[model samples]
Target: MAKRRALISVSDKTGIVDFARELAGLGVEIISTGGTASLLEREGIPVIGISDVTGFPEILDGRVKTLHPAVHSGLLAIRDNEEHRRTMEELGLGYIDFVIVNLYPFQQTIAKPDVGYEEAVENIDIGGPTMLRSAAKNHAFVTVVVDAADYAGVLQEIKEGGDTTLETRKRLAAKVFRHTAAYDALIGDYLSQQAGEQLPERFTVTYEKIQDLRYGENPHQRAAFYRKPLAGKGDLTTAEQLHGKELSYNNINDANAALAIVKEFDEPAVVAVKHMNPCGVGIGTTVAEAYRKAYESDPTSIFGGIVAANRTVDAETAGMLSELFLEIVLAPDFTPEALGILTRKKNIRLLKLGDWSRAAERKPEWLVTSVAGGMLVQESDVLSVEASELKVVTDRQPTEEELKQLLFGWKVVKHVKSNAIVLAKDNMTIGVGAGQMNRVGAARIAVEQAGDKARGAVLASDAFFPMGDTVELAAKAGITAIIQPGGSIRDEESIAAANANGIAMVFTGVRHFKH
Candidate 1:
C-alpha cells in the first residue's frame, strides 16, 4: 500500500505544530501551504510544500493556491474504487487521508475599530472553504478537522490505529460544515451592513454559545444560552456574575427585562421584573429611595422578582434588598459592605455591569422573536419623547408637575406588553397592568391595584383608546392626566370624555406597542 498523506493548512496555528509532528512520527507525509509550511519547517517538522505536491506555484497572492484539481482529487478520490484509482494514476494524484484547516479571521478583522473595507475583503478565505467542503464531502474516505480542540482526539485515534474511525470522521465533517456556514453568515451580514441594506434578500445571523442551562422555561424543556459574536459593551451577556448559583433560563430573561427598563431613566432607578413583565419601576435621587419606592409599588409581586438598578448598590440599599427573597440583583457596582450583606443569601444572583453609561446609550439595531416556522425581526424601540413634542388634546391642559409624571409614565409604559396601562406618580410606578386582552380591562386592573394612589397619578397607554370607556374608567379612578398616541377614529369621544370629566389628555403621535 502507498504511504498515507495528510494536508495541513490553517489560519489559526494553535496546536498545529505538535499535531503535525505526531503525524510525521506516525509515518504520514505532511503537505502544507504558505505560512503554515514555513512555521512547521521552522519548528523542525519535515514538510512537503503544497507547490511541491501540485507542481504549481501559488498565484494571485495565495488565493488560487488550493483551487486546483490536484488538491480536490487527492481529497475526493474514492479509496476502494478501481475507476478512481485508475484516474488518480493517470493524473498523478495522491490520496489524501486527512485535511486539517481553519478559515481566515474575517470575524476578528471586522470587529476591529474603524476597519477598512479592503482589509475586511482581503481576510475572506476562498481556498480554505473550498478545500474544507471537498474534504468533508468525502468523509467516508477522508478525515477533516476544523477546530483546534479536536486535534487531540484525532491524534489519539491515529496513534491507536492507522487512521481516524469512520464515526469520528463523520462528526468532524459535520462540525466543519457548521463552522463554514457560520463564517459565511458573518461575512454576509457585514457586507449587507456596508451596503446599507436594512433587509437583505437572505438574512443570516450567528451567535456563539455561552452556556447550557439546566433547563428551559420548564423543567422538561431543553435550552442553551447564546450571545452575538460581536456583542457590544454593557450588554446582558457582559455582566459579571459575582455570586449565586448558575443562572436559570427564567432568571436571565427576567433580568434582561429589568435591565432594559432601568436604562430608560437617567436618575438612580430600580426595576423589578416578574415573568418578563415589570411589576414595579422607580427613579429617585438615591438607589435606596428607588428600591423603597419600587418595593412599595407591588410588594407582593416583588418577592421572587429580579431587580435591576442603574447605580451602585450601597450598604443601605443592600440591607433593604436582603429583606426580600429576590431571584437576582443587577447593578453597575457594589460596595464591599453591600456584597457582604447580599452574599448571605445562597440563591440570589449578583451581577455587576461593565459600564452603566454605555448600557444606557447603546441600542440594538434589531429585535428578533422566533415563531413556529420562522422569525419576526424589527427595529428596536428606542424612541424618546420630550415635553415639547406632546400635543395637549383637551380643554384642561396638564400642569407642569403632571407633564413630568406623564413623560415618566410614557417611558415606563413603552416597555410593558401590549394592552398595557401604567399609572405613575412622582416618577414611581404606582400600578401596572400588562398583557390584557382589552384596554379597559387593563385600565381597570391598574386602577384597582393603585386604589387611592391612582387619584393624582398620570395614566399612560401603549396605544390610542378605541372607545371612551377607558377614559371614563380613568376619570372614575381620579386619574388627573392621560398620555396616549391618539390615532383612534373615536378620538372625539375620548376627548369629550376627558373634557367633561375635567381630565387632561395629550397625544404623543407615536404609538409604543410591545407585543
Candidate 2:
C-alpha cells in the first residue's frame, strides 16, 4: 500500500509538535512549509518540504509556494476512480490524505497601536485560505483540520481505523468554511473602513465570543456574550469587573444605558437607570454631590438600579452608594478606599472603565436593530445642540439659569424613550416620563411625578409637539421654561400657548426621537 501523506502548516503552533510526532509514529508521511517545516524538523519529525513536492522553489516571498498544481492535484485526486489513478500516475502525483492549516494573524496585526497599511495588507494570507477551501471542497476524499483543538480527535480516529471517518471529515470541512469566511469578512471590513465607505452595499461584522451566559433576558432562553474584534476604547466590552457576581443580560443592558447617559455630561455626573431608562440623572461639582442629587431625584426607583458615574468614585460617593441596594456601579476609575467600601457588597457588580478620553475620541458607529426578517442599520445618534443654538420662540426669553437647566434637560430627554418628557432644575432631573403614546400624556406623567417640584423647573421634549395640549399641560404643571424640536405644523399654537402662560420656550430644530 502507498504511504499516507499529511500536510501540516499552521500559524498557531499549539500542540503541533505532539500531533505531528504522533502522526509520524502512526506511519503517516508529514509534509510542511516554511516555519512549520523547520520546527517539525527540529523536533525530530521527518517532513517533506512543500517546495520539494511542488518541484519549484518558493518564490514571491513564499506567497507562490502552495499555488502550484502538484500540491492541489495530490489533494484533489480521487483514490478509487480508475481514470483519476491513471491521471495521477501519468502526472507523477500522489494522494494527500490530510491538510492541516491555520491562517496568518491579520486580526492581531491590525490590532497594534500604529499598524501600517502595508504591514496589515502583508499579513493577509492567500495560500492558506486557498488550500483550506480546496481540502474542504474535497473533504469526502481528504481530511482537513483548521483548528488545533481537532488534532486529538483526528489522531485518535486515525490510530483506531487507519483513517478519519467520512462523518468527522464532513464536520471538520464545515468548520473550515466558517473559519475562512469569517477571516475573509474581517479583511473586507478592514479594507472597507480604510476606503472610507460608511454604508457599503454589503455590511459584514465579526464578533468573538466572550462568555456563554447562564440564560438570556429570561431563564429559558439561551444566550452568549460577544465582543467586537476592534471595539472602541471605553466600550463596555473593555470594562474590567472589580467585584461581585457575573453580569446578567438585564444587568448589561441597564449598565449600558447608564453609561450612555453619563457620557452626555462632561461634568461630574451620576446616572441611575432601571429597565434601560434613567430613573435619575444629576450633574454636580463633585461625584458625591452628583450621587446625592441623583438619589434624591427618584429615590424609590433608584433602588436596585444600575449606577454609572462619569468621574472617579471617591470614598465619599462609595459610602453613599454602599447605603443603597444597587445592582452595578460603573465609573472610569475608583479610589482604593472606594473599591474597598464597594467590594463589601457581595452581589453588587463593579465595573471599572479606563481611559475615559477615548469616549470623546471615538468616531460615530452604526446602530443596528434586528427585526423579524431583516435588520435596521443607521448611524448612531451623536447630534448635540448647544444652548447658543436654541432659538427662543416664546415672547419671554429664558434666563441664564433657565437656559443651563434647559440644556441639561435636553441632554437627558434625548436619551429617554419617545414620547418623552423630562423635568429638571439646578442640573438635576426632578421627574421623567418616557415611552408614552402621546406627548401630552408624557408631560402629564412627568408633572405628576414631580408634584410640587415641577413648579419653576424646565421641561425638555424628545420631539415636536403636534398640538398645543402638551404645552398647556407643561404650563399647568408650572414648568417655567420648555425646550423641544419645533417642526410641527401647529408650532404657532404651542408658541401662543407658551406666550400666553408667560413660559419661556426654545426651538432646537433637531429632534431626538429614540424608540
Candidate 3:
C-alpha cells in the first residue's frame, strides 16, 4: 500500500505543531503551507511544502499556491473506484488520507474597531475553503478536521487504528461545512454594513453555541444557548456567571428580559422578571432602596423570578435579594460582602456584567423570528420617546412628577408582551399586566394588582387604545395621566373618555409592540 499523506494549512496555529509531530511519528507524510510548514520545521517535524508537492511556486502573493490539480485531485479522487485510481495514476497524483485546515480570521479582523474595507477584503480565505470543501466532499475516504479542539481526538483515533471511523469522518465533514458557512456569513454581513444596506436582500447571521441547557422552558423540551458572533462589548449574552448552578434556558430568557428593562434607566434601578415579563421595576436614590421598591411593587409575582440591577450590588441589596426565592441575580458588579451573602443560595445563578450604558447603546441590526416553516425578519425596535417628543393631547397637562413616572412606565411597557399595561408612580412600577388578550383586561389586571397604589399613578400602554374602555378603566383606578402611541381610528373616543374623566393624555406617535 502507498504511504498515507495528510495536508495541513491553518491561520490559527494552536496545537498544530504537536498534531504534525504526532502525524509524522505515525508515518503519515505531512504536506503544509508557508507559516504552517515553517512552524513544523522549527519544531523538528519534517514537512513537504505545497511548492514541493505541486511542483509550482506560490504566486499571486501566495493566493495561487493550493489551486493546483495535484493537490486537489489527491483530496477529491475516489479511493474505491478503479477508474478514479487509474486517473490519479495517469495524472501522477497521490491520495490524501487526511486534511486539517482552518480559514483566515476574517471575523476577528473585521471585529476590530479600526478595520477598513480593503484590510477586511484582503483577509478573506479562498484556497483554504476550497481545499476544505474538496476534502469534505470525499469524507468516505478522507478524514477532515477544522477545529483545533478536535486535534487530540483525531490523533488518538489515528493512533488507535490506521484510520478514522466513517462516523467520525462524517461528523468532521459536517463541522467543516458549518465553519465555512459561518465564515462566509461574517464576510457578507460586514460587506453589507459597509455598503450601508441596513436590510440586505438576503439576511444571514451566525451564532456560536454557549452551552446545552439542562432543559428548555419545559422539562420535556431540549435547548441550547447560542450567542451572536458579532455581539458588542457589553450585554446580557456577554455576562459572566460568577456563582451557583448552571442557568437553565428559562433562566437566561427571563434574566435577559430583566436586564433589558433595567438598562432603560440611568439611575440606580432594579427589574424583576417572570415568564419573560416584568413583574417589578424601580429606580431610587440608591440601589438598596431601588431593590426595596422593586420588591414591594409586586412581591408575590417576583418570587422565583430573575432580578437585574443597573448598579453594583452591595451587601444591603444582596441581603434583601437572598431573602427571596430568586432564580438569578444580575448586576454590573458585586461587592465582596454582597457576593458572600448571595453565594449562600446554592442554586441561584449570579452574573456580573459590564456597564449598563454600553448595554443600552447596542442596537441590533435585525430582529428575527422563526415560525413553523419559515422566518420573519424586520428591523429592531430601538426607538424611545424623549420628554420633548411627547405631545400633550389633553386639556390637562401632566405634572413634572407625572411626566417622570409616565416615561418610566413607557419604558417598562415597551418590554412587556403585547396587550401590556403598566401603572407606575414615583419612578417605580406599581402594577403591570402583560400578555393579556384585551387592552381593557390588561388594564384591569394592572389596576387590581396595584390596588390602592394605583391611585395617583400614571398608565402607559404599548399600543393605541382600540376603544375607550381601557381609558375609562384607568380613570376609575385613579390613574392621573396616560401615555400611548395614539394611532387608532377611535383615538377621538379615547381622548374624549380621558377628558370626561379629567385624565391627562400624551401621544408618543411611536408604538412598541413587543410580541
The count of residue-pair clashes in candidate 2 stands at 0
Highest TM-score: give the candidate number.
3
Candidate 3: Cα lDDT at 104:
86
Decoy 2 TM-score against native:
0.93
Task: Give residue 447's error in model 1 in angstroms.
Answer: 1.2
Residue-wise C-alpha lDDT for candidate 2, range 299-375, written one tens digit per residue: 99999999999989999999999998999999998999999999998999999997566355335677888899988
Q: TM-score for each prediction?
A: 0.96, 0.93, 0.97
The models' CA-based lDDT, in order, is 0.92, 0.92, 0.91
- Each candidate: RMSD: 1.8, 2.3, 1.4
How many clashes in each structure? Answer: 0, 0, 0
Tens digit of per-residue lDDT, candidate 1, span 16-81? 999999999999999999999999999999999999888999998888888888999999988889
Among residues 3 or more apart in sequence or in different chains, the pairs in candidate 2 whose N, CA or C atoms overlap within 3 Å are none
Off by over 4 Å in 1: 356-364
lDDT of 2: 0.92
